[model samples]
Target chain A: MKVLAPIAAHEELEMLAAAGAEELYCGIVPREWLERYTGAVWLNRRSPKGGSLDSYAELKRLVDDAHKLHLPVFITLNSPYYTAEQIPLVLELAHKLSDEIGVDALIVTDINLLMRLSQEKLACELHVSSVAAVLNTEAIRFLLNFGPSRIILPRSVTLAEIATITRDVGQQVEIEVFMLNDGCAFEEGFCSTTHHHTVGAFCTSLSEMDTQFEWAGKSFTTRRQNWLRRNLTDYREWVWYVNGNGCGVTPKGLPYGPCGLCAVPDLQRMGVASLKIVGREASPFKKLASVKMVRDIVNRTRAGVPKLHVIERAKQLRESPEHCAAGFMCYYKVDESA
Target chain B: MEWSLHIGGAHELASELWLSRFVEADRSQLTQPWSELAGRLLVTEFGDIRFTHCAFGNEFCEHLIPSVSALQTALTAAQQQQLSFTLLTPYVSNEGIAALRPLFERLAGNGGGEVVFNDWGVLNLLRRDFPTLIPIQGRLLNKSLRDPRVTPMYATAPAPSSALNVLQRSNLDCESYAALLTGLGVQTVETDNLPQGNDLSFAQYGLRIATYAPFGFISTSRICMAAGLHYRKADKFQPGAPCRHECQTHLLEYSYTNSPFGNRDQKFFLKGNSYFYAHTESMLHALFAQIRAGQIARLTWQPRLPMTVAH
Candidate 1:
């Protein structure tokens, strides 16, 4: 499997490529779009401030530099959906990125945008974004009608579901899974909440709110309610911890968040094509360390290491045995019974 | 205009009060014109709202999909009450799809009905195998911003008008989006009574709109907190874990004291796997005005807080 890492600026190219990134993806919001829609309407799922490149020239430079290292570059246009007026601007950007700047593919989420891209017959490959929420084989087949060359499964999917999907449609299209960083409390595709820095994310802000539990239209006993509240508070804290503790890195400079290294062999056996490292808005140092961490596991899996040993190596690399033991940082829930 | 009563189970269809109100409205509708039906609107409460159709099934969690026998029972009740039936479906995995195949077949075999698909896969299955069933795009797929926490931001923020417009609009605002649904054999689309309000101008695209009132969902997840309430810390927050439907017996309510948007105290309800906020009276009044103006074709009334009710 290939390592797909996030790229933000032209300067991060060499470090990420040297760290063993086989593919790169980024989001760019051109000046014209920013002037009209403002940062409030994001071109992608991330905030437009640090999340995307500001100009076409910057994107072209990044694409050219990555191509020199034999790394394929993909651009994200993966907002849940675009309005009628916004669709034309998005289509024009897709064309310029694919036809003019020489990007390898466009990672898109909206169904209407996909249909328009397929009908227009853009020169680049179309990789459906995980925001499109392809959870089952039938969804993959449905999206296949529009002709996406790759499908990124949502983070909410289990390993068993991933195996079933790849088994059914792996031959038809390449499959990608989230490997590290950035986990959502809800299914990102179905979540319609805004991610603006001003209001913050709805899910994260939930921790600050007060909670109460009622059963059958009556409040639970004080003791049970207290337990439920504590459970909720602990769960939210764990989710926050897994999401890089507000996108923080450890003292050793290793990125800390959700990790899926233990599932490398299972994914490889399932014919998965790529392992994606999320966080385009992250610093270059964090991005490089994340890529290196994933590259180590991919290499171990390729070297015919025993699955149990690979899992053990993955746990050791995280440097947080307690978190691993608690299973708070697992992206894929590995079934021990299996 | 038409009104539909949405419920999660077959037992809701057994309520004589609900059946009597719907049957009386159906009888009055046989003689009254469609335009005059708006005058008979009584927005007192869910019990008073007259409906012409019944929508049954879960729209957020596949684990809550009704059994085939339960579906049959609901269908029979709808038929006996002389109302149309619409089956609501959620986003599902392969296992969920397998479980729903028989129910879809049963619905299709029983002289066909409307199916509200929250997932594209379910829509694909309907178009492929259950051709007899008409598909209605559910609100989960509408992709509209329904966050109540940010409701005050739209009015107080220094953002441009275009940005706010994007937030207020739904996918139906795009002509190609509506056209795509129409091409998929969908003549109707569903939406929530958004806190920031809605723009029903998409009705011009030859697509009818159904707006759910009183309770609009903000977000949902497979990592069910309700399902794991009794599990240990190490076993908590597990996605796709089996449960005894604990959500049916409990509801979590949240109140935010210091909202970044404004001084208004924001509140939401967490039932099962989703979080929802009750729509304000002003929003409901606007919805009624839109319905009276012929923009919204249907109103799906929910008597309960979450669409999923306790037995």
Candidate 2:
């Protein structure tokens, strides 16, 4: 269970560690936080030309060329809340990424910057962000008193709620999950909207908007609300449906979004130590064909194979062919009897 | 400094003249009885001390799990309305904290209950196992920006002061983030009356805020397209399927004409699944002049029910 990915540059670190990427996460935003929060505040949740990195000397040479190939970089001060003059420039860039560019973990998602990095002990490894929704096991025993080593999780739970949180706290912490690109139909830490200026990612413009079905004491020009809006014109039965379907992008176009690779054999029998792969503003050759297609489906689920031939070898490495039977570009969903 | 009446589901038409019922519902229409609730509700007032979601979990909509005989008949009708109960949680998973340990031991033996935590793991499981209830802070932890397509462009422009300070600032207006939510005993914070307005300056961080009104949930999803329209299979609308509650049967009215400043009539409301934006009475008379300038001490309100009613 290790693919992680998403590094933004320093020449995409040896093609994302020669297209396997054991671990790499990123986000930097320098140039004085894009000349004073120009993307209307964002030192993380991307946008300094998205998937940041404009110096800490190019994130100390992309964490010294991905820690000479053993990977491990992490670093996205995942914003879901951060103000108080932007918390001392996000705790002076988390104390220069933990005292001058050493970063091995900081993902975060503002529970007041995880209680100010566990009340300023701030050494490094913190993780927690799927914008900190955490989802159960009492929010991982309430972020195990903010000494996180990993949490990610929230893509709105269920793989039997991630096997009821890695079977109860899966040995205290480290869970990670979303094995591929963006899928949120809202729940990124209770989505407060404004994902970026100019209608872009407010949950993908909340699926091309349009609604009105009033009647708890009438009037939207009630005639049974105009015959329930001209016979509910079937915008695929709304509630912001969304299913454009894309196993495509990145000729520097970059959006090979939503791809669970049929839930990597139940997130490796729910041990899920890490799968991640979201596109920190993608395209390092679509993050090297999504870290060589989830490192060849996590090495064919560690070579034990047969989860229906690793989901027909992850539907022939996602040329889809209706493999995940496209349930809105499903990520973990793959049941019709596997 | 308190008005409350959120009631998310069928509490025999709630109303006993305020003082609480953020009573949302889910664990099967929260033990129904507002004339057998199958949605289409809208009554007001409060009392019969009820505020629910025992285990505080909801990304935006999908609740109702209460059963310990429906929290012992909603705690014997909130101890015959001597009222002192509140529980609306969400964001839980150690199997929803082992299925909310018998509704946190029935709100820790009901000694004046109250528990609205939008998951700081249920305020560290009510500060290590229900230390006699009372936590309050859930408006999905109030992250702000409640977008009904940019609240009509932050209600007619002039919002670029870093987008009106990230839409009326709040990390509980930092004083060490309100002393780390009042050192976790969390005195109260649940707010959201923002149709592009609300600078009740996090009521200077001392906590005790409580605002909510006319629907303020900008996001929520256990992947329900109104409980996947009786599943003729569109991935059976995802999240553990089989929900016949059908957003308590109908309510999905969205209408945003692409406002990235293109701006046009933007109305959004969808009952019982989550997506709302409706607060004008001059935004409740500017939240009643910030509840008579005490900078909002409590309001809660929410009329237009059936997001499966259980606040």
Candidate 3:
């Protein structure tokens, strides 16, 4: 399996690559990250030297090392917006990712932007991202037609469904499933508006702390389909002080808490081209330990059997500093669904 | 009977020729290139052809749309005089819709042609803004398929694949698609590059995001997604230049499909499996065929058939 090591820093990338990492996925660089952060004074886009550091240079260095080691890289492109003002910049970066930097694929979320890339720009592989809400066959079929090189499967699937999906789709296109640490309540494809606040340019991920989404009157929210029946075309089901009613999205099925309940066996049966372990939030030691656990299971899966033991693994990883356990989201699923 | 043919004349071919300019810097290639492409388009008698007013990406929102007079000039000079063509714009943003009024006057200056829009807000907005111009909500607002889960992600031994479940499940998606059409009073739902077997037009009415795949033969398409697009509009010129390629992606690949091989597979879907968008287009052809032929096998929910009766 192509093991995608989710690293927090460039230094960690080398460590993971040495740990048999085949691919890497990372967040926006600090320099770039500071600029778009939504809050006026904090993230100055006009900053002359970019940010406090030229992280892109560091990023390029990491990319060079990965390329030398024969590891592919994917940059995260998940964000929320309507007009698609992101295309030109996206295209330019993709060009660099291919021509100079050489990142293997881009983990993207938008369709209109993706279509233009496939048609007009970019020579790199388009790996389907987790945020695209591609959960079902029709959704998969819809994305498949676009000719993505691989699909990063949603975190909501069970071992059985992944097997069925793998059986139907095949391993050639490459499937990157989240093997450890991270699962959300929202449908992976349709719901994102999180992580950044629009109206301002400084509400970066760091600033937007202590926030969680929940329904306004979920109990009162009608269970009926298409809440806007009287005005069928109108998607304004709920009046929002900010955006439209989830902008055609409903609040149902959003898990209320932790992710990672079915982590163990899930890693074993997914059969994706890569078994990715989401890091970032986890402690460094836990990050290393989590990678080791998943890598071991994946290596064993080649023997035609799957490995799992979420409860024990979670217990074992508790002593480490980066303690967001692999099954961190697991308990939350049960609590919310219950 | 031969299925509906989307034949492009000299005018329809111009958009592609304009796009081809970016690929090849040589000015000569753009000038007479379609002489060959148009010949290829005309001999194949088409039922309808489409000429969108805007470039496919969001960048075109700020630019001035080429005037209808310019479009008319192109049409007049084009080879095929008898062939019919139409208009489709994905979103029809406020800036674009305003530019469209004058452009449409030019497209219809020759006494007649149709203009169909894709965005829902644009449809409602246009009904208020451009009451005279014909509108067709691009599949963006009224999708060909939508997957609303009623059962667990995984079912007991042997159930329909999640890909097929949206089709089998409560037909909620079909109902939504048909109903929206009835309410909006649209002319047609635009779809391209559909699945081989199922036709969006006839298979069953459903709405979902579909992507375009110009290469490789894929009948199944991107049937699943990983997650959803989570946007945070912070800035365009943030400290570090935006990753040009990251901006190109309409939605996050990891966030959406389980099968985002878009760059490799060259496919995608907007709300759902944009990867298998070709299937959605194919489905549109089937629906158009059955609807035009006046035979809808399963009108489980036709929204409002009476309203759709063109005659």
Each model's iRMS: 5.9, 14.0, 22.2
Q: What TM-score, to 2 decimals, does candidate 3 have?
A: 0.41
Ranked by TM-score from best down, the candidates are 1, 3, 2
Q: Evaluate all candidate structures by whole-model CA lDDT and list the values in order.
A: 0.82, 0.66, 0.39
Alpha-carbon error at B62 in model 2, in Å? 14
The runs of at least 3 residues in candidate 1 whose Cα sits more than 4 Å from the true structure, single-residue gaps closed, are A336-338, B15-48, B155-159, B307-311
Question: Each candidate: how many clashes?
Answer: 0, 36, 168
Order of candidate numbers by lDDT, starting with the best: 1, 2, 3
Docking class of 3: incorrect
Per-residue alpha-carbon lDDT of model 1 for A50-142, expressed as tens digits? Answer: 968888898899999888899999999999888878988999998899999999999999998999899988889999999988888999999
Error of 1 at A321 (Å): 1.0
The candidates, ranked best first by DockQ, are 1, 2, 3
Model 3 chain B poorest ten-residue lDDT run: B302-311
DockQ (C-alpha based) per candidate is 0.46, 0.24, 0.02
* Candidate whose lDDT is highest: 1
